[model samples]
Target: MKISIITVCYNSEATIEKTLKSVESQSYPNVEYIVVDGNSKDNTVQLIQQYNSIITKWVSEPDKGLYDAMNKGIEMATGDLVGILNSDDTFYDEMVLQQVANFHKQNNIQASVGNITQHNEEGKTVRKYSAANWNPEKLRIGFMPAHPALFIKRELFDKYGKYALDFKIGADYELITRFFLKEKISWKYSEITTTAMLIGGVSSSGYESYKLITKEIAKALNRNNISFSYTKIFLRGFWKLVSFLKKK
Candidate 1:
């Protein structure tokens, strides 16, 4: 199945080239690449034009924000499967999509979630590599594969609707919660499909943003009838660090 990979970007000249090259260099050539930029005031647009041959479509203008840009990408996707690989991130290798497509064909799941690894600004692998096995029970406390590692059949959005526009930082979490928890959609796990990321996006840049994430996670769990305490979340967060130590 052809996959549409959407990238949401804003003033990402330094990194957008890497993201675009990663998409273009893929061994699986059927990717329909769409990039939605929020009016980057830099050479990001220039770089995009340089690689215009491989990109199926691209736009650079002001957008509501990350989620809004992503919504636009989803609206533009014409492939059978949809996935997001943000401007700040790149594929682990050229064969990553080929691996994901194989797993998709082998499993009966509507969505696929994979592993990830974080890297420094210089692209040195830093940390990350968690075993996020999907299940309704595991999800109660708080469980999610890396957002960048997720690939859903395009029809899932056609059926479930797009992400909630109200959420600021946690819209994706809410979408996953609704799709996997609220509606009980089946998902498949990819042991090493995508890299778990840590490129310090807007969400990871400050304490206030993290506080917002905590509040949102609590709100999400409350809606799902799962009681999560700060301590519980802290332990889970610590394991996130511990995850880097265990080599698979």
Candidate 2:
């Protein structure tokens, strides 16, 4: 199956090269690479042009935000499967995509996700979300598969629709919840490392991080006909604390 790897970038010159190279080096041959740039004032567009031969399509234009750029990407994609690899992250290995394809064929799954490592610019591995034990229940309590770990069919986009633009940082999280939590989707978790994403993302370490997450979580729960309870939050918080201790 063809995999359309779309990357959304803006002022990402510093890291875009590595991201492109990672995709280009993939063992999977049936791949389409598309880049949606937010008219970056930096060298981001120029850097992309350097790989013009490999890049199936690329455009530099102004967009509303990250999710907006991503929607543009989803619109442009024409592959059997789709996966977004941001300008700042990369695959764990060249064979990652190839293996995902084979795994999907064997399991008859439309969506496949794996584990990921949150990292820094220097490539230091941060917290591994360790989504090996993922499920909707674990997700309701705040656990989620890393965005980069997902490889979904373009049909899923057409079926469930693109992300709602109301959210900023948590749009992807919300999209997954609405799709996976509300319906029976063909999905499987590959017990293997997939992506290494740069840590300290747009919302992770901000002063208003808690507030943003709180709003997103509340919205997600409300949409799914679920309710938030102090008990759930307390248990999840305690689970996080224990996760950290176990890591050490």
Candidate 3:
């Protein structure tokens, strides 16, 4: 299977090089890499230009936000399967894409998820996130797989839908919830760790961001007719707190 990796970047000059190098090192021969950059004032665009030989397609232009950039990348993708990796994140190893591609080819599933290891500013492991216990009912309680470790077939997006643009920080959660719960798509889980992401992502940077994320998550749940409760939001917050504390 041809896997298309979409990386959405904005002012990512500091870390995008590692992300691109990781993708370039993928052992999967038929992988197509596409990057959507949000016209950064920094050297992000120039940095991306360095990988022109490997990146199938890339665009640097003004966009709404990360989700908008991702939507654009999805529209540009032509591979059988699509995977999204953030600019600040990277695959665990060169074999990550190969494994994901082989899994999809062998299982014939619509989507699959693995694990993500989150690192701190010093690049030390902070927490390892996975969807080991995720189920349809668990999604109703605000649990979701690591977005960076998720890989889905292109047709799934064509059938179900893309990310909701209105959601700033919770679009990934909303889209995944819509897929597993509302659309009822089948998914496979692999215990293998796929990606390494940074802590303090957009949704977890501060208290205000947390509020926005929970607000958008509630909106997504209500839109999909899932049980919505403030406690669900609080539980997510509690987990974040525990993750940070454990890291310390």
Query: TM-score winner among the candidates?
Result: 2
Task: Give lDDT tens digits, candidate 2, residues 15-126.
Answer: 9999999998898899999999999999999899999978999999999999999899999999888888989998889998898788877888878878888887778886
Model 3 C-alpha lDDT per residue in residues 1-248, reported as the tens digit of each score: 78899999888899999999998898889988999998898999998999998999999899988898898999999989899988999899889988887787779688898999999879999888877866766666667888888888888888888888988789998898889889888889977689999898887787788678778878888889988676867587687678669968
Task: Report, for every candidate in turn, its global Cα lDDT versus the true structure.
Answer: 0.80, 0.83, 0.86
The stretch of ten residues in a row with the least summed lDDT in candidate 2 is 228-237
- How good is model 2 by TM-score? 0.94
Listed in order, each prediction's TM-score against the native is 0.89, 0.94, 0.93
Q: What is the lDDT of candidate 2?
A: 0.83
91: Cα error in model 1, Å: 0.4
Candidate 3 TM-score, true structure as reference:
0.93
Q: Candidate 2 clashing pairs?
A: none
Pick by lDDT: 1 or 3, better one: 3
The deviation in Å at residue 197 for candidate 2 is 1.1
The deviation in Å at residue 45 for candidate 2 is: 0.6
Ranking of candidates on TM-score, top first: 2, 3, 1
Candidate with top lDDT is 3
Q: Which of the two candidates, 1 or 2, achieves a greater lDDT against the reference? A: 2
